[model samples]
Target: MRTQALGGRPRQPRGGVPFMLLLAVLVSPAALAQGASRGARLFAQRCGTCHSVGEGDRVGPDLHGVLERRDEAWLTRFLESPGALIDAGDPVATALLKQFNGIRMPDQPLSEEERAGLYTFFRECTAKGKGSCKPSPTQKPGTDATPEEVALGRRLFEGTEALAQGGPSCLGCHDVRGTGVAGGGTLGPNLTFTFARHGDRGLTPLLAKLDTPLMRELYAKAPLTEEEQYALKAYLADASRDGSRPRKDRDFFFLGVVGLLAALGFIGLVWGPRGTDPRAH
Candidate 1:
């Protein structure tokens, strides 16, 4: 048969057309899935720290249904150079900067292929519904905080729960919105927007090393556990979403009273009793 086919275009392979068709049908879906997967990874690495696809705004606007809100062409231009658009005073860009509390969505420098992938990922997220889109493995799950995490974080930050390693409590020098009247001290900066301002990329490293002049001394011997850091980060992230606000004044008088009481109790412990001295004859 092969000898005969050599004279007549090799008579084609039997069932060749059907086999090729089958291969295309089997491979196409996998190729599409792979492309979308790649897109998701790119989105997480480049855009996810500051923007959420469905879960509400982070440091920037939520990108769910973004293509629906803004045309792909416009989005392309904006994503490529957000600062340029803002500088040119594009009305929408200006409004976005204002709406998100003056935090600019940083420009994402992407080639055409990467931009296409991100666009694809955003579309997939919109189709999946709010909070349904699972990020690629490369992404951190910090885009949204669970209620449990926020509550635990709150307790940890307020010193109501003791830290594992006896590190300095955040409440000793910082304040948050719901920390209450006597809750937080004011020696450090208010952390209302610290997470929002720094996001995971900037904040995670800072927390891990505890390298600041004061933090090094304070937490050097008693570093925060990973769990503790995550919990506190969750709490601060929740507060950051609340945006900037005035810190409530701490009840310093109560603190002074407590300190005085503690001092007297220590003296009593060292001496014989509350009314007695160690040197009594």
Candidate 2:
């Protein structure tokens, strides 16, 4: 007679695997795909600023076939806190820092599940072949953009047209040459050559997230709409290209000087000379 288990089922003949262990081994392919999808989105949003998969080096090195080069445990530790690895003088991490012009990778705090997903994503990319995985293509506002789109971009940049999301206009913070007589605000850096400096890859992610401290604070609630982003990007690209040509900035300067003098003259007429009363004279 077979021995009965607590649930009235026959016991295993010898050493059998437990039910919980069997269930743990049975993950569906759909579940794995979902994790990989999440990882891809996260990478595009966060890592794409500094790194790419198969594309050549950006701010950081290309991560294609990174798994084959570094062990998973070491990669995990490095991802958790690169600065720590650098501080501890890990040979590989130190070499990476030196190779990348000493720009230390920022710590990426990811939960185990998220990390596992990233590993899956990386493995999938590696399996495809060298340089097989590429960043998702972003819409570039290049010379191909129509004149109308460029005009809309100018309007949006100069705040002549309101942003759909009611976010602060670019002119309020950034200065772009040829915008107007006064130009743009001085609080932020001049954006005349921004496109030339960052190019499409860098600018796309920056615009998508606006992840800088000040920008995040300002645009956390009021984000730019897709149309607004495109228009603004187009305008900036145009501005960068046009920066090479000579502009009539001297005329604007003279006009501002004349305006200032007129304002002073009007003030004098209204208030008269200081320390002298019209009634006394």
Q: Give the number of the best model, judged by TM-score.
A: 2
TM-score of each: 0.40, 0.40
- Sliding window of 10 residues with minimal summed lDDT for model 2: 1-10
| lDDT (10s digit) by residue, model 2, range 1-281 | 11111112223333233432332232222234343366675676678789889877988999888889999999999989999999999999999999999998888788987888788878988888767666543354344467887898889888889878787777866667789559876545466656665564445556655644446677878887766677777777777776342234343233333443343444454246655745455
The reply for model 1, stretches above 4 Å from the true place, is: 1-141, 243-281
Clashing pairs for model 2 are none
Supply every candidate's count of residue pairs whose N, Cα or C atoms clash at under 3 angstroms: 0, 0
RMSD of each: 26.7, 26.5
Q: Tell me the TM-score of model 1.
A: 0.40
Evaluate all candidate structures by whole-model CA lDDT and list the values in order.
Answer: 0.64, 0.65
Off by over 4 Å in 2: 1-138, 245-281
lDDT of 2 at 275: 52
- Candidate 1, after superposition: displacement of residue 23 in Å? 60
